[model samples]
Structures are given as C-alpha cells and as structure tokens.
Target: MMQTRRKKLSEWVQQLYFIGPSLFFFSLIVLIPFVMGMYYAFTNWNGVSNEVTWVGLDNFVTIFTGDENFANSFGFTVRFTITAVVLTNAVGFGLALLLTRSIRTKNALRTIFFLPNVIGGLLLGFIWQFIFIKGFSAVGDATGIGFFNLPWLGDAQTGFWGIVIVSVWQGAGYLMVIYIAGLINIPSELMEAADIDGANFVQKLKNIIIPLIMPAVTVCLFLTISNSFKVFDVVYSLTRGGPYKSTEPVTMDIYFEAFTNNRMGLGAAKALIFFLIVAAITLIQVVITKRKEVQS
Candidate 1:
C-alpha cells in the first residue's frame, strides 16, 4: 500500500510537471481577468479612478432600457453572422471541390486562395480600404465601369457589403482547407461504387459526400459563426462603424462603451452579457450540427 501510494504521488507529480506552467499562465492571463471583469460588471467604476461603487444590476438595467446602440449593434451582428457563415462555407466548399480535382495548377491555386487568410485582419482592412477608395475609382475611370465607381465604403449599404466581401475573402480559404481534408479522407472505393451504380454528380454529392463531410461542416459552421459574431479588427480599421453607426457590431459597441466612453463598469456588464449571448448561440449551433454529423 505504501509503495502504491508513492507511485501514485509520483504519477501526479509528473502530470503536474507537464500541466503546471500552462495552468499558471492561463490563470494569470484569462481566468483571473475574467473573474475580475465579472466583479466589475456590478460596480460603477469609470476605468481610471480607484473608487468603484457597487451598483447592483443598474448597468444591466440601463442596457436593457436605454441602450439603443447596443441593441442595433447586436441586430447587425446577427444579420452579418448569418450572411457571412453561409457565403463563407459555400465558397469554401466550392473551392475545395475545385481544388480536389485532377488539375495541373490545383496546388498553386490553393496556395493563392489561402494567401489572404494569412494576412492580419487589421492590415487586410486597411489594404482593402485603400483599394476601395483609390484603386476602384481608378479602375472605374479607366474602364468606365459603373460597378467599380460606386462608393464601396462611403455609405452604410456599401460599407456592410464591403465588410462582408473582405470577411468572406479572408475566411473562405481557411475553411476550404478544412473541407479539403474531409474530402481527401473519403474512400475512393465509394466513388467507384457510385459510378458503377450510375449515380450522377449531384446524387453522389447529396447522398454521400455531404453526409460524410458533416464533421467538417460542424467545425466550419462553428468557426464562421463565432468569428463573424466577434469580428472587430476588420470593422475597426475599415468602416469604423461609420455612416451613422449603421454597420456597428456588438464587439465595437462593447469597445466604445468600455474604452471610449470611460464606463468600465458598464462595459464589463456589456461584455458579460455579450459573452453569454455568444456562448448560447454557439452552443446551440454546435448541438444542432453535432446531431447532423455522420460517421463514415
């Protein structure tokens, strides 16, 4: 018994040796701040002063009753998330299908398509801002193209579509990689059998490919939903939630509330609420997609 106890203790020590550093950093960077943010959510701290007054649910109350901007931001976020998720996944799957074909330039094409995702969102936004403002106008003037001449980032409608285009361009490539992984793992014999059975491309895709790739679908949907919902850097650099705050997302709203307005406590409250909403939505999405997943 004594020997067994010593062995158990040694095993635990080994486990802790591997995990202790990660746990310590996680607590320092994430866990502690999260707990403190929760505490501050109930207070009336202005983010600068040391004086923090407890205000109970006043922050939440104000949000529910008087926070039109937050509500509008949230609504826009939902719309954006839906649109971005569908387009990103659709484009990604299409690219994956095209790239998986027996073509000489497939490898180079994959690299080119995925290159956009490597750039940072902030930098991409700024780059695209210049392109929309200057490059498009030059193209419009040179080619007499009305589409290129339209103000891509000057107004709310164009700004929304502009952000969407950038997001889809950046995200679709990463998702294509995931879908390609799923596609390559599918057994070749299955396709051969389907061909022997005289199954058309649409029939095989609907009955076999999609069902088998449901796991990748789940992952892609979860990523697109969460990323779209939490998008900030791109919007911050590109639109700045401008044109009378029409394209503002929930994250920008929270940022402005906390940092710009000096309402740290209120910002904390908003952050907590936003966290809960995002958590719930992602959870529900995962659950739904998980049910659709099939074992190949």
Candidate 2:
C-alpha cells in the first residue's frame, strides 16, 4: 500500500508539472479578469477613477429599463445576428458545394474565395468604405444608373446592409472551409451507392449529404452566430454606429459605454449580459444540432 501510494503520487506530480504553467497563465489571464469583471459589474467604476463604489443592480436596471439606446442596440444586434447567420451559412455552404467538385480551377477558386477571410476586418472595412464612397459613384456614372450611388453608410437601412455585406464577404470563406472539410469527410462510396440506386442530385443531397454533414452545419452555424453577435471592428470602422446610432450593435454599445462614456460598471454589466446571451444561444444551438447529428 505504501508503494502504490508513492507511485500514484509520483504520477500526479508529473501531471501537475506539465499542467502548472498553463494553469498559471489561465488563472492570470482568464480567471482573474473574469472574477474582477463580475465584481466590478456591480460597482460604479469610472475606469480611470481611483474610487469604485458598489451600486448593486443599478446598472442592470438602467440598461434594461432606463437606457433607450441599450434597447435599440440590442434590437439591432438581434437583427444583424439573424441576417448574418443565414446569409453567411447559405453562401458558405454554396461555396463548399461548388469547390467540392473536381474542376481544373478548383484550387485557385478556393484560394480566391478564402482570401477575403485572411484580410483584417478593419482593412476590409476601409476597402469597402472606399467602394461605397468612391467606387459606387464611379459605377453609377459609368452605368448611368443611380443604384450604386445611394448613401450606403450615411443612411440607417443602407448602413445596416453595408455591415451585413462586409460581414458575409469576410466570413463566408472561412465557413466554406469548414463546410468543405465536412463535405469531404462524407464517404464517396455512399454517394456512389446513392447514384447507383438512381438517386438524383437533389435527392442525394437532401437525403444523404445534408444529414451526413449535419455536424459541419452545426459548427458553421455556431461560428456564424457567435461572430455576428460579437461583431465590432467592421461596424466600428465602416459606420461607427452612425446615422443616429441606427447601425449600433450590442458590442459597440458596450464599448462606447465602457470607454467613451467612462461608465465601466455599466459597461461591465452589459458585457456580462451579452456573454450570458451568447452563451445561452450557443448552448441551445449545440443541443439542437447535436440532436440532429445523432439522428443523422
């Protein structure tokens, strides 16, 4: 019994040696900050001020009940999340399907499609900003049509669409890569057997491909949903939540509350709430998708 206990102790010591550094870093970076943020969420911390006073649930109440902008930002975030999730997944899956085929230019096309995702969001925003501001007018003049000349970032609806367009363009490629992995993982023999059984393309896709790739769909959906909810850089660079805060999303709102308005406590509260909302959404999605995956 003494020998056995010594062996187990030695094994545990070895394991701890390997894990100690990572645990230390994790505690410093994530755990500590999370605990501090949670604590500060209930206080009135003006960020730079030396004094922080406990304010209880005042920030929460203010955000949900008093602040009109918070509600507006929340509404905008919901709308953007829904639209972005749908469009990003649809386009991504479509690209995956296209690139999965054996074509001469498949590799080049894949590279081209994925290139946008590699670009920085802020840079992409600036590029699109130029397009909306200058390139659109040039197209309008050349085509003798006013379609491209509309004030994209200057109007509320147009700014919202502009954000969506940039988001879809930037994200679709990454999601496509995920979908491609899922698509390629499906057994070719299954598809061949389906074809042998006189299964048409649509029938094979609906019955075989969709079900088999349900896991990929779930991953893509989760990524898109989370990304859409937390989108900040692109919106900030492009519109700055302008046109009367029409395009302001939740993340942007939280950022402004924290830094610009110097309301760290309120901002922290908003962030906690945002985190909860995203966590709940992701959990629900995971549950539903995992069920579908099991059924498939």
Native-to-model Cα distance after best TM-score fit, residue 54 in candidate 2, in Å: 0.7
Residue-level error in angstroms, candidate 2, position 74? 0.7
TM-score to true structure, per model: 0.98, 0.96
Alpha carbon lDDT at 103, candidate 1:
92
Q: lDDT of model 2 at residue 252?
A: 92
Ten contiguous residues minimizing lDDT sum, candidate 1: 287-296
Q: Give the TM-score of candidate 2.
A: 0.96
* Candidate with maximal TM-score: 1
Worst 10 residues of 2 by lDDT: 287-296
lDDT of 2 by residue, 1-296 (tens): 99999999999999999999999999999999999999889999999988999999999998888899989999999999999999999999999999999888989999999999999989999999999999998999899887898899999999999999999999999999999999999999999999899999999989989899999988999999999999999999999999999999999999999999999999999999999999999999988998888453
Cα lDDT of candidate 1 equals: 0.95
Alpha-carbon runs more than 4 Å astray in model 2: 294-296
